[model samples]
Structures are given as structure tokens and as C-alpha cells.
Target chain A: MSEFFSMGGYGSYIWGSYAITAIAMIALLLATLRSLRNSRIERDQLETVLQARRPRRTKKAPKAS
Target chain B: MHRFAKPSVFLKLTDPLLPWLAGATAILIATGLYFALFASPLDYQQGDTVRIMYLHVPAAWMGLFCYVGMAICGAMSLIWKHPLADICARATAPIGATFTALCLITGSLWGEPMWGTWWVWDARLTSMLILLFLYLGYIALVNAFDDPERGSKAGSALALVGAINVPIVKFSVDWWNTLHQPASIVRMDGPSVDPSMQLPLALMILGFTCYYFVLLILRVRLELNERRIRALQLSGMFDERSDQEAEKANSYDAGHNAEASQ
Candidate 1:
């Protein structure tokens, strides 16, 4: 509603507070997710290298007389 | 439950959850802010200043909620050594502190017009301020020690001590006559607030809760991976040493065979 945005005259202060809070929350969320993604990628790389280094097992043959 | 505490399992479970939680948080916050800002009716008495309550109240609630959450996780970390518990406590601290900070700032913003001043040393505000300090102290103590385990144990003790402050913060208005209004939104009898205003308030609270969960899950995921990386680093070192030993043993065996052949 037009009246809602007008806020009967205190709109700036009230909405300002909400805006700042929301922005802060969003920033925190983004930072957290970004770092999490980086860590996950790093871990995956480590796991892959470790796996590659592991020796592959092969079956051995036996001869009968 | 304890089995899920394994880092690999936690990482896999959280892998899918991270994006979902983040998406949920964004939707909740956008809708909540829309409702809070555009849909809700202005207060009859306090007019627009009452809008400040949307951020202040939910943030205050989360400030308390987060500390309680941290305390429980810290206790679990200390007793059972739940690998994720200490990390949870660590991750939640900054978010809690931010909410507490928001509460104080918005409380000041609300007070300036309504109370004719920015702050008063009233019971409610005083207790809430102390709660903020408690959060900061816990965060500082937890990171002070060189050893992670030592820091965690010490932080756990601080968190337990700080839990006592939560009740004091909640009940301070009732325990004493104060400039701050008593519980208007959450009460045994029912919220004294208008229904029009209540809806937006409820939305904001839900949004804030979702935001907290989003952050918690993301942070915990990072922490679990960090632990895994640490383990991997140690394993890498062990692998290098084992490889060197194997190479040395093979060289020694080859030399012995060659000597026999000669």
C-alpha cells in the first residue's frame, strides 16, 4: 500500500534499520557459503590425489603339473 | 547419531543441504522483508517507529537462541568429543554476536524517538548489553589457546557459565520496573500486539531463523571439511614417510640379490 511505504512519515528510519539488518544477514550467508564451497573443493582435490596414489591390486596366476 | 558425526558422512549429508538451506534463506528473507515492509499496517500508536521491532525483536530472540545452541553444542563437545560440536559452537558465535549487535543498534534506534534518548541503563537494556558482552567474551576465549582442544574445553566452560545470562536477559523486564516494555509479542496470555502487526513480526522471525540455519549449516560444513583437510595433511605426511621406508627396503633387498648373483 502507498500508506505502508509512507509509514505515516517515519518510513526512512524504520525501513533503514530493516534494510541494514537484511543486508548484513545476506552478506553473512554468502560469505559462509563461499568459504564452505572452497573448503569442499579443496578436500575433494586432496581425496582424489590420495586415491590416485593408492596401488591397484592384480590377480596372480598359478600353474598346475 | 554419533555415526553421522563421522566427517565423511557429515560432508556428504551437508553437501546437498548447503544449497537448499541457502535458497530457503534467500526466499524467506525476501518474502519476510516484503511483508514486513510493504504489507504490514503501521502501528496506531507508535506509528512507523514500531517497524523497528521487526528487526530488534527477532534479533534479540536469535541472540539468546544462538547462545543456548552454542552452550549445548559446547557441552556435547566437551563430554562426548562430538567432532562437529566444537565447530558448531565456533561457527555460531560470530552469527550470534552479529544478531546481538543488531538488537542493540535497533534497540537504540527505537529508543531515540520513543524514549526520547538513545539508551537508558534500564534492567532490560542492561541485561541485554551484558548478554552481548558475554557473547564476545566466549568468542575471544574460544580462540585464545594455541591448541584447538584446549580452546574448545575452555570455551565450553565459558558457554556453560554464560547460559545463566540468558534467563536474566529474558526476565529482566519482569524482575524490575524498566523503561523497556515487557513481552508484547510472546507471552503466556497471548501477544498483546495487533494481528496486522503480528503477521509481519512472525514473518521476520521465521526469516531470521532460516537465515541462522543457513549460516549454521554452511559454517559447519566448512568446519568439517577443514577437519578432513587436516586429517588428509597428516595422512599425506605419513604416506611420504611410508613410501620412503618402502623404497629403502626395496633398495636393500635388490642390493642383497645382486651380491648373491655376483
Candidate 2:
């Protein structure tokens, strides 16, 4: 276990490369997901506002029986 | 092909694909890591430090691939004026930049231990650095203008221009004496590395490719949604402006009626 972690004395270099790659990829994924969520929220809000502003249609009254 | 260029259709088509792509990426990466760390034998030359190649090489490849993808999208946007192409190019910039950054940082990390230096301004390294700058420049140019269309146009042109660096980065080692080694896997003579190493490398490349697509689809969706919101706001502004005009006209008529009665 310790030997595996040590990586024959080049452990720091190997681990550093992997760690940075992992961090960058995760960061990008999170940022992309967050942006998607935010955009969806904004779109929904705008759509709702537009729907509310639209003029409501009226129904005609029935003739006297 | 052109049919999917519509943002609405694009969103519909890619919505179903994201889950599969993400799942494949996760599986591939896990397998690749397993193979890289445990199964692959130590290099007789570099020892365990060669493990860095698994991540470093794939990232460098992806950085180049993404730039090429961006350039193609830029061309489509510029020449044919494909609507989604610009958005795709825009979506690709940041992702490519990140990949390029990863490549550089990992390369540096690998270099420090192997070459006994942190960095060298060699042909390959310098060209890759230029690629990173190109990605940054495209991102900045795309958002610099008030008119999004104009910004996209400018960015597309810049991307097209910067594409010359891609080939330079690829062939830099062969063209000049550099601290970085020349191509090993992608040669006419075939890959020089052991089969064990190649498997993990291939898996890592595929995994990274999957991740790129997943992010690209998400970013493109966000771009489309943002555009929709902008259009909605603009329409709403137009509606409000017309309403104000109608109100002003009504007041003017009311005043005229009152004066005539007086």
C-alpha cells in the first residue's frame, strides 16, 4: 500500500499530474452544470413572465333562453 | 446534418445523449485508471514516472483535438453562416482552454522530474502555449462585443486564423530539436510502447473524448437557452414600448376632447 503510494520515488510527479487533471475536469463539469442550471432557471422565469403579460381571451355570454 | 443546426432540434437530440455519454465517460475513466495504475508495467527507462504519460498524453491530444473542432465549427459559422456552429465554437473555447491548461501543467509536472527542469521554451511547448492563448483570445473576443452576432463573427475569424498553430504544435518536435520527445504512438512505424500501456492510453483518450462531448452538449444548451431569454426580453421591451405609445395617444385624445368641450 505504502509502496504503491510511493510510486518508486516518482510518486509526487505522477500523483500531481493525476490530481491536477482530476481537479480541472471536475471543476469544468461543475461549472458547466451550474451554467446549465442557471440558464434553465432564467429561461423559465422569462417564459412565465411573458405568459402572464399576454392578454387573456374572453368568453362570449349565452343568449337568453 | 443541417436539420440539427436549429437550436431547438439540437437541444432535443442531445438531451437524450448526455446520460449515455456521461456514463460511458465514467466507466472508461475508471477502467483506464485501473489499467494505468495497476496493470501496466513500470517503464525500464522512466520507472513509475511513465504513468504520467497516461494522463499527460491524452490531455495534449484532446487539447489539439478540441482546437481543431473549434476551428471547423468556426469555418462552418463563417462560410455557411450555420446558426449552431458559432454557439458550438463558443462552447468549445473554454473546454479546450481547460484541456490545454491541463496538458501544460501536467507536462510541467512530468518535466520537472524527468528532465530535471520545470519548463523549457521548446518548439512543442511554445506552440502549445500559443494554442492556450488562442483559446483565451477566442473566449474574450466572442464576448467582447455588444452585438452577439458581431462577436461570433469576430471570434470565428480569429479561430480560423489561429488554426495554423495546430499543425505547428503537432509537428514541432520533428521540425526542431526539443526537450520533448517525438511521436511514439502515432508514427508510420506504429506504436513503440507495450500493449499494456497502449490499452490504458486508448481508454483514457476515449474517456476524455466522451467527457468533451458531454460538456459540449451542456454548454451548447446553455447558450441556446440564454439566446432564447435574450429574444424574450427584447420582445418584452418592444411590447412595453408600444404600450407606452398607445397610452400617450389615448391621453392626447382625451385632452383634445376636453379642450373642444371647453
Q: Which candidate leads the pack in lDDT? A: 2
Candidate 2 Cα lDDT to native: 0.91
Each model's DockQ?
0.60, 0.77
Second chain alone, TM-score for each candidate: 0.85, 0.92
> What is the lDDT, from 0 to 100, of the residue A48 in candidate 2?
89
Q: Model 2 TM-score? A: 0.91
lDDT of 2 at A61: 15
Taking all chains together, the TM-score of candidate 1 against the true structure is: 0.82
The reply for model 1, stretches above 4 Å from the true place, is A1-6, A48-65, B1-4, B11-24, B238-262
Q: Return the lDDT, model 1, position B246.
A: 61
Q: Residue-wise lDDT of candidate 1 within A1-65, one digit each (tens)?
A: 76767677767667778777868877887888788889989999999987776542111112211
Give the distance in Å from residue B27's predicted Cα in candidate 1 to where it truly belongs.
3.9
How would you encode candidate 1's per-residue C-alpha lDDT over B7-96 as one tens digit per residue? 667667777876777677677767777777677776777877887988899999999999999999989998888857888999899899
